[model samples]
Target: MSGLDETLLDDTEATVRVRFVVNGRKVACEVAPRETLVDCLRNELELTGTHAGCEMGACGACLVQLDGRAVHSCLMYAVQADGARIDTIEGLTESGVIADLQAEFHRRNALQCGFCTPGMLVNAHELLSQVAEPNREEIRDALSGNYCRCTGYEAIVDAIDAVAKARCEGGGAT
Candidate 1:
């Protein structure tokens, strides 16, 4: 067989097995070489909290923590995350890692349509973990990638700022 034929054969091969520790649970699934991590998480693993918006890296709707860092799930192939630790909104919620953020979002009415909430919360969690006390401008800068079509970002920024203050004061809420 020619080299091109070999390449074609490889492309037509069966699904590849990918493994990850998701939400403190071990998960393994077979995915096509082209299957994105968002598809794997939502379709294969049945974790739908991670939304797929724009299907590109520009939108942060498919954000998930990969190996302790937020990443665009829609841009990463499942095979690329093999044997990695993945955390979707479901995982973070279950772990109570973002409870304060969730509460602040609710109190501030930061979320509107709920489509971008998961990604926003995930990114906020990541930002807070990195910078305990980020100003409003810094918060906005961090959320520049995530797009929310519902409410103006004022409430979101307010919520994050409130959370930051609460956390610093050890109150956990504003």
Candidate 2:
């Protein structure tokens, strides 16, 4: 095929093989070019911790760490994430990086239905990394994108704030 034909051929391929590190383990998948990362994780890998909501980047329920940064999995294509490091909620739990935050979230009643907990934890994980001692306002701002229908945002804010305070004081699991 000529150069233009090859380009079109690559674009029209039904599925692309993507290889990446998920949660710390390397995984490879053959996914449709149009499949979103969340779909790949949920459908192909059976990693269901990343919820599907809004699917347009508005709701943060599908948040995951892409290359150490929080991103909406629903908004990212699986092929686009090839060769990248992806960390789902399960990975964070296995690593124990979010143990303290999870404990605080439970203690402070941060989640009720638990649908948004994973995304909330993912975003909270990012915030705690950037700011060791975030105030209530800062915590609220960090979690603004995640929506919780059960909790009124107060408990979630308290949980994140408590964890931030404990970490800043050097008593946290950091």
Candidate 3:
């Protein structure tokens, strides 16, 4: 092949460098321009907690907190995360917020298959962060994007409501 053709080929196959802060750690890596955030997290950063289901963003299984907001990893390009703060499921529990929620989930038997647990936890965390005392309707609205094939959502709502009630009574609500 000619030099020009080789250059074109390289350009087509070139991996772009993406820089971002994941779970409070700086990360810089080369990834295909077309790669999604889920791929980068799982394959490059090795943060497998971000699941890939219904890659079209319909299923909230790939939920992650980007710049303090919950987003579907499969819907975002890895390059778009440059200079962003990313938090996968691994980061959710480190601050003890998710731990409390997890305890509540266990107490409520909110999880069954566990595939949707991470996304549910992250979404719940986001909801609680924004509204410390969200009602059942609000909690359901917050989790509208997430799909739970098991557990039927009653227990999940109960868990969240209990946590909210506890926080309100404990003066943890702001």
Prediction RMSDs, each to the true structure: 2.9, 2.4, 4.4
Q: For candidate 1, lDDT tens digit of each residue in 46-99? A: 999999999988879999999999999999899999999999999999999999
Task: Give the RMSD in angstroms, all C-alphas superposed, for model 1.
Answer: 2.9
Candidate 1 lDDT at 11 equals: 64
Comparing 2 and 3 on TM-score, the stronger one:
2
Ranking by TM-score: 1, 2, 3
What's the TM-score of each model vs. the native?
0.94, 0.93, 0.90
Model 3 quality (TM-score) = 0.90
Clashing pairs in 2: none
Evaluated at residue 49, the lDDT of candidate 3 is: 81
Report the number of clashing residue pairs per model: 0, 0, 0
**lDDT winner, 1 or 3:** 1
Worst 10 residues of 1 by lDDT: 1-10
Write down the lDDT of every candidate, Cα atoms only: 0.92, 0.92, 0.88
